[model samples]
Target: MHTPADSAVAIQGLHKKFKESHALCGVDLQVRQGEVLGLLGPNGAGKTTLVKILTTLLKPDSGHVLVNGWNVTADPEKIRSTIGMAGQYSTVDGLLTGFENLYLIAKLRGVGRRTARRNAEDLLARFRLSGVAGRPAGTYSGGMRRRLDLAAALVGSPPLVVLDEPTTGLDPESRLDTWDAVGELVAGGTTILLTTQYLEEADRLADRITVIDAGRVVADGTSDELKAAAGNRLVVCVAEDHQLDAAARAAARATGVTPMVDRRARRVEAAASDGPAALGRALTALEDEGVQVLEIGLSRSTLDDVFLGLTGRARHRAA
Candidate 1:
């Protein structure tokens, strides 16, 4: 068993309530030191509440909680000092230059004027914001502003960073840029609790993922482990859109599972119990039905499948 001493963040029997809504119910979670832990859940899944508690923004009704070896309720100030938070919305002032934002945050963290300036400069360089550091943050692109916000969060070199959907509403290119920035943080051994709607982001960055639903953790494991437990996937692509129905039926028949159809991709996928054997059967069925097959394969399950299996929300190609 792991103790709070060994964990970057730990909670047991955590509960939170708001009016008649039970936001979190007996939720237990742990994030190891130096690991990126992806906190995943649907909307109202207590993700934000849990983050709030961990970051000292909110208190849990009843539970034992610790961050960086400090009790959350007893040492809320200490916990706050060790955590850096970047939420979905940009928090930087539009009127301030990127350097000013970071510098101000550094000063707020209680560093001396000289140290604060140095810290701001270092962070800007670290996050690739130095070239535009002098420009007003309002003039920065979405991705640049996000990078700036992230830089401000690191001003004091907090041990743990909490990112609550750091890439929301970003264009595809901007999203990729933010992912790269997060990757750099992971490489530097920062413990991160990241909550995101992008399943792919969790799959790419998280050393382990904790899935919560209805205010409780339903699954916790590495990406591969979660995907493996979800079962193998049988995928088939048809050459024509009209053949999609036939392909889906063939996959379902072979895998003994309902298939998910993606019309634009002309693809049908489902969980398969027998892997390669199911692929063979699917191939035979499609051939017999004269459906032109573009691609067919049996592979390990993706994070998308794991998410769908746990949440029961088939958000096709979850953004």
Candidate 2:
């Protein structure tokens, strides 16, 4: 049972270092009870390190972490008991059946033998893995294994669950199924702290988001709030391959900011306060200059835009 006022997780001035790399630098965050907080950052941005610290798997060199009002350092054992974690890799044993894997976790969580069996079976059915419960986990597809891993995390019925890139390798359908499961857990009043590189996933699942770059928090807010802070609308236009430079110039003149040109894509992208009107002006200007427009549209600012603005780089590898 968690009180509304009791924060699910709280960290203050958290710092960690490995060799010369500063993994976390003066990081501070809080996740309210029953809320889903998304941690977004590029690789080497300290998202996983923060999750590890909160889950009591690693200790910060300085600062404090409190989970359910218990200090992580002073009450590590208690914190571990209250928290469940599923990392990027599935932890299901390849040699064991899905049911056996879940059964082992239930027993480890102190459930009686009969209860463990019942719990394992129920979880398998709930995750829609009962059909393959007897099959060795090694034979499971990527999506099935991910579902099993998530199911195992719930064996303890922990109040808080930390998911670090839980949907990294799943197909679109699998990701949607996983999202539904997460929603169901949240609806049941479980607090979740999710770390992911997928902006769309964060937008879909998080109540609040914290964006970290170079080991420090660069932004924190809801998805819409962060996007608003990133500035304004973006207008993208594709032109004939040979006319890209002229189109870029036209866009710059219309928007009063130099547009970014992607020669390979024959596209020019620029930001503007009023995207639709700006795009229309740019298009008209381009046509006046004898430049043929292929396509044009105004796009809402996204978390990716926020990351690029703050970090001076894209959050993920270029597609």
**Tens digit of per-residue lDDT, candidate 2, span 72-183:** 8899999888888888788889999999999998888888999999999988998899999999999998888888988888886889989999888788888898998888
The TM-score obtained by model 2 is: 0.87
Candidate 1: residue 171 Cα off by (Å): 1.4
Query: How well is each residue in 1-319 modelled by candidate 1, as lDDT tens digits?
Result: 3687779988889999999999999988899899999988777788888888888889889998889999988999888888899976899999999999999998898999999999999999998999999999999999999999888777788889999888878898998999999999988888899987678888888999998888989899999999889878898988898888888888888998889899988889899978889888988998888899988888898887788889888533335
Best by TM-score: 1
- The residue-level lDDT of candidate 1 at 147 comes to 94
Worst 10 residues of 2 by lDDT: 231-240
Candidate 1's C-alpha runs over 4 A off are 236-250, 261-267, 280-296, 316-319
On lDDT, the candidate that comes out on top is: 1
TM-score each candidate: 0.89, 0.87
